[model samples]
Target: MLTAERDELMRIIRQLSYEQREVTLASGRKSDFYFDGKQTTLHPRGALLVGKAFYAALRQFPAPVQGVGGLTLGADPIATATALVSALEGQPLPAFIIRKEPKGHGTGQWLEGRKNVPPGSRVVIVEDVVTTGGSSMKAIERAREEGLEVLGVITLVDRQEGGAEFFAANDMPFVAIFTKAEVVG
Candidate 1:
């Protein structure tokens, strides 16, 4: 269920991040418009709204969700926000950070914050934006390698550029809070 706060988050995203200009995405695709989700996700109010909304969304999963996370840099803030909000809501959701590659030193881990989560735990992967789904896919793969069961994926924005299709093709559940059309139009 969408709330006024979530709607306001969308509005903030459009106002702060969405832009009408040719841009190249991480997927190496060129588009007439772009959404730099970090701009909004990192903001104080935006983070609070995202945390509340994402926590609400995660609660809708048919199965229990023990944690939330995704690839770092983009997913970092979302994961932290969700976890913090979940804690405040009396349902603690630990956040994990999946590295693009394992660290070169100090335990050389691929996943940071793994200690908070146990093996075989159910987790929902998150992303700020979904394009080709490469980053999300990598995070899922890494989670599976660590014995985590990926229940579903959530993204702040879906570009309508094959990401949803990719998850469907791979038999993974996916949800997006907003879409490019919803924000840009």
Candidate 2:
């Protein structure tokens, strides 16, 4: 069962992120509304609520996940918040970051937090929003490349676009804290 924090996060998203304006999404699709989840994910109260809500939701996955992570920029704060909350709860889920491209210097790798989560660790990809699931998919691909097992995906919000179907088509388990309609409708 979800807690009130989930509802609070929705309220924050609606107030700060959701906007009924014509916008083009990262997926190149035109949308009637835009939800730049960073607006809330970066807020103090919003971050707290996200951590609490996502931790509660993460507990529902049948397969245990040792770490949380996803593509950078958007997923960065979500993963970090969840990881921090999990640690405070005494479970300590490590967080990883998947870069859009391999770093140019040093090891030139694609994923960060590698030491915290060695190969074969079970992890769930976390995202701020899900549109086409393309970004999360890339993260999953990179995770697999690093020998990590992807248990599933958790998103702050689902645009109710093709993301769920995209994940389902790829046989990936997915859960969203809020849907587009739930936040703005």
Q: Which has the greatest lDDT?
A: 1
What is the Cα-based lDDT of residue 139 in candidate 1?
92
RMSD of 1: 1.2
Tens digit of per-residue lDDT, candidate 1, span 2-114: 56887889889989988889988887888988888899989999999989888988966876899999998899999999999999989888999999989998899999898
RMSD list, candidates in order: 1.2, 1.3
Error of 2 at 26 (Å): 1.0
lDDT of 2 by residue, 62-148 (tens): 757788999999989999999989999999899999999999999999999999899989999999999999989999999999999
